[model samples]
Target chain A: MIEIKHLKKSFGSHHVLRDVNLKIEDGKITSILGGSGSGKSTLIKCMMRLLDSDGGEILVNGKDITKVTNPFRLAAVRRHFGYLFQEGALFDSMTVGENVAFGLSYLTDIPKEKYPAVIKEKLAMVGLKEEVAKLNPSELSGGMRKRVSLARVLAISPKCILYDEPTTGLDPIMSDIISDLILEMKKKIGITSVVITHDMHSAFKISDYIAFLYEGEIMLYGTPEEFRKTDNPYVRQFVDGSSHGPIQMKLMRE
Target chain B: MFTAIGKVMMNWLDQTGGAADMVRSAGFWLARSRFEFKQFVLQSITIGVDSFGVTALTSLFTGMVLALQAGNTINNIFGDPIFVGTIVSFSLIRELGPVLTGVVVAGRAGAAVTAHIGTMAVTEQLDALYTLGTNPTQYLVIPRMGAFLLTMPVLTVFSNIFGVIGGYLVAVYALGVPGEVYLSDITTFMGAKDFMHGFIKAFIFAFMIATVCCYKGVSTRGGAEGVGKSTTGAVVTCIVLILVLDYFLTAILAAFGI
Candidate 1:
């Protein structure tokens, strides 16, 4: 389980995360749903230790990563996470196969000779063909890039995977395929996941628990049914995508 | 006015402090990652061998121009161009070869490193590497730094040889000086220490360019615009520093009686 308590982050005069708190259970998907500028992505980045929180306790399996100073120890803590970026973020200089093989070659004790087999296996898991391995990331389409990014993350075999807007830009069909793959990851591998997305349908389909992030805080936290039943103006505004609700359009413009 | 000055000061301090931290981390990782021999070799070839054309061209022109002007001036006064080879070899081996080569690298390779690293930073590939338990300073910066340090001197040597050849062509054929006189004068006036002087300067310039460019690159923010800014910023900063450092290095070498 991961516990984020009193997490606060600010940029100059703008406070991005304000007294935010969350509890993410293991072996299931917990989706943090929020509109743009709602700090959902910031919350996950802070949890991943990519951005430092001005004030917070981020406990990963009971150890506070914020306080860890040693490079080796901090890296060891970070190794537990596999973060998939919003834009796939594959290394542009390397080919598709080399991208997935990078972590395997660098981080693991796996033999150098077995890297090709391992790369092939991970790409196949992401439904990527072996022929695409030779092509550069720039040559791939958006959906294929995301799948290759997923393959790269899975190469590390991290304890938990963090997805940031996994289905943001894809078509409905492609999004559903990604959602199915995410669900398969949870059901088949039984690994923990924290998905950050604003897509209500995808969140409802894949998440065991959904947390609504608003103004840098969790406005509501519960199962899908509980979320649907909530009449809170903030929650309603987001769930229904209503412009008439309490969430002003200007503030959500960020 | 005070606020603007304070902001500038703070920005300078912040960047300087960040550079120091990267240097520290790079030192630590470089010691542990001696096994990245393959990466070092690849980067060396890219930074040095692939950069042959531009550096060679710059050195060639500078040498040719130097010989041409010197030959004309000496011929006007003495009715014969004399000491053209001595002047070309001395000036090149002492200053132009290393300095011009350093400037070319700062403009070309330094910007490339910043663009490469800055794009990775903006794209969150750096975060991906971190999440995989790989220190980017070790995986990225160390190999590049190692390559630059290993190859800058070699590039300097290539510049020196090409520069002399260019000067020889100008002095003998273009200026109508005897080929034997020009060749013998180069052997006569230039010392081993003169070549070594520029060679040592190449190493220092390489270290500075690598550190400055990589620091700016890794600390890049914003996005595509930020990477463009970093590439420009790195090249400008590296060139200015290379020039300033050239003066200091010359002074120090002179003081050492080299």
Candidate 2:
């Protein structure tokens, strides 16, 4: 289980996450859903120690990694988590196979001869063919890039998976494909997963629990079923994808 | 007005503090991490080998111009142009060779490092690297630093030789001076310490350019516009710092009786 306590992060005076708290249960999917700038991404970054919290503690299976400053020990903790970034974030310099082989090449004790096989195995896991591994990220479509990113993540064989805006730029069909993959990952591997996305359909379809972050705090966190019955107008507005709601959209006025 | 000044001062202090922090971390990582030997060698090829053409041209032209111009000064004083070789060799070896290479490489390689690393930062690749348990400092900064440290001095030596040859061409063929006069003067005026001083400057310039450029890169925020801004900022910062560092390093070296 991963636990985030009183998590606070700010940029200058504008606090992005304030007093946010949540517990992510082991071997379950927890989708952190929020509107733009609602701090869902920040929360995930804080948990992964990509961005430090101003005031918070993230206990990963009982160890608080924010305080783990030793590079080797930090790497040991980080090795257990796989991250799929918002834009796929494949290295531009390397081809798909090289990107997939990166972590294992640098950080692991894997034999040099097995790299090609390992790369192929991870690519196959993400529904990518071995031939596609030779292609650069620029050659792949957005969906293909995301899948390649997923393959790269799986290359490390992490204990937890963190996905930030997993379906951001993909078509609806592609989004559904990613959503399905998320579900398949959970069912098969049974790893702890934290997904940050505003796509409620993907969130509802894949998440066992949903966390609605607003103005740097968890305004609502419960099962998908609990969210369906909640009276909170802001939550309702976001879930329904309606323009008229409690959440106001600011515009320029003459 | 006082408050506004104070706010500006605060921002300056903040940025300086951040740069200092990155320097300290980069230094620590450079010390602690296992040298990625392959990366160091590849970067040596990239930073040293690739930039050879432009660096050579700069050295050759600089020495030629010094011969053409300064030969006149010696002619005016001595009634002959014999001392042109000595002056040109001395100036090229002690100052112009390393400084020119540093400036040119700062524009070429420094901007490249910033753009590449800045693009990675904006695209969340750095964050991804961190999540994959890779230290960005070790993977990105250290190997590049090592490459620069090893190659910059070597490049300086090459630059010095090319520069002297340029001066020789101008003096012997263009100015109608004897080749033996040029060669003998070089042996008389130039020594190991002059060459060592220039090489030492190359190392310092390499260190600053790598650190500043990488710092600008890693601190990039926003998006594509941020990457552009960081790249531009890096090049400008590198040029200015190389010039400023040249003066300070020279002064420091002079103080040590070099």
Candidate 3:
């Protein structure tokens, strides 16, 4: 379980996250829904220690990971969490198989000779053929890259998987495929998964619980059914995708 | 006004703290970066291959220039053009060859490596490495450092031999000096001490260039413009450090009566 307490993060004079608190239960899928500049990405990044919080306590499995000092131990803590980057973040220089094996090779004691088998298994789990392993990331399509990235996350056998806008830029079918993969992984490995996305359909489909973020705070947090029934104006506005509501789209003046 | 100044000072302090954090993070990454053997080999070849032609050409010209200048000066003083071989070989091997090769490599290889790594850093590939539990420094720095350390002496040796040969060609064929006399003077005058001095300088130059280039590259910000700036900065800094250290090393060597 990952717990965040009284998290506050600011960029210069502009506050991104304000007195935010949340919890991600073990062996469950939680989706954070927020608009652009709504601090969802910042929250995940803060939890991962990719970005420093101005004030907060991030507890992973009852231990305060935020204050961990020793680098190797900190690395061990980080190794337990798998992060799927928004851009796929696949190393362009490495082959798909190599990229999948990247985290495993670094974090585990697995020998080089056995890596091919591990890579094959992980790729196969992600629905990629063995031949795709030798192809560079640039050669793979966007959907394929996302699958490869997912394969990489599973290869590490992380306790929790963090997805940052996993279905962004994908067609509806591709998005559904990725959403299904997330659900499959949760069912198969029982891994706790946290997905941060603005896509309401994707969020509603895959999430067991949904947290609706507005103005750097959790405006509504509950099960997907509760989320749909929420009378909160912000949550209602977001869920219905209504233009004439409390949420106003900023106009760009030329 | 006082309040504004105080705020500025505080901001500066904050920036300094951030820089310290970045340095600490870099040290951690450097520790982990050492594990990727394949990346190390690729970096080594990248640093060495392209610079080979330039290093060779630079050494040849440096030798010829030294021979021409020393030939005139020594002829006027000793009335023996043959002594030019000793002067050329000794100077080239002990100082000029290593220093020149270092400068060439800095411009050719150091800048390229810095830009390549710096772009990767700005693109968040470095962060990706960190997230994967791999240290950027250990993976990136160690290989380049290893390549620089291993390849530099070889380049220096090539420079020294090529420079001497260039001088020999000029002395015997171009300047009408006897081949046997020039060859014998070069063989007799130059010793292991001179070679040792050159090799030592080469090692120091390699460390300086590799470290400075990597530092500049890894520290880069902004975007493509920042990468370009880092590349130029690495080459320039490497050249400056090489010259500065050469003078200091020469002084130390002289003090020891080498």
Best by TM-score: 1
- Tens-digit lDDT string for candidate 3 (B8-44): 8996576446545545655666665455577677877
Worst 10 residues of 3 chain A by lDDT: A245-254
After superposition, the stretches of candidate 2 with alpha carbons farther than 4 Å from their true spots are: A249-254, B1-13
Largest DockQ belongs to which candidate? 2
**Model number with the top lDDT:** 1
* Cand. 3 TM to true fold: 0.87
Could you give candidate 3's per-residue lDDT for residues A1-254 as a string of tens digits?
88888888999998999877888999999999988888998988887777778887888988888787677886787887888888788887788888988887678889889999999998888888999999998898888988998898888888999999999999999999999999999998898999999888888898999998877788888999998888988788888988767675432221
What's the residue-level lDDT of B233 in candidate 3? Answer: 75
**Model-by-model DockQ, in order:** 0.73, 0.75, 0.57
Q: Which ten residues in a row have the lowest lDDT in candidate 1 chain A?
A: A245-254
lDDT of 2 by residue, A168-224 (tens): 989999999999988888888887899999998899899999999987889999999
lDDT of 2 by residue, B114-230 (tens): 888999999888887787657668788777877878887888888988898899899988888899999888898777888888988998888887887888888899899998998
Select the stronger candidate by TM-score from 1 and 2: 1
TM-score of 2: 0.95
Residue pairs clashing, model 2: none
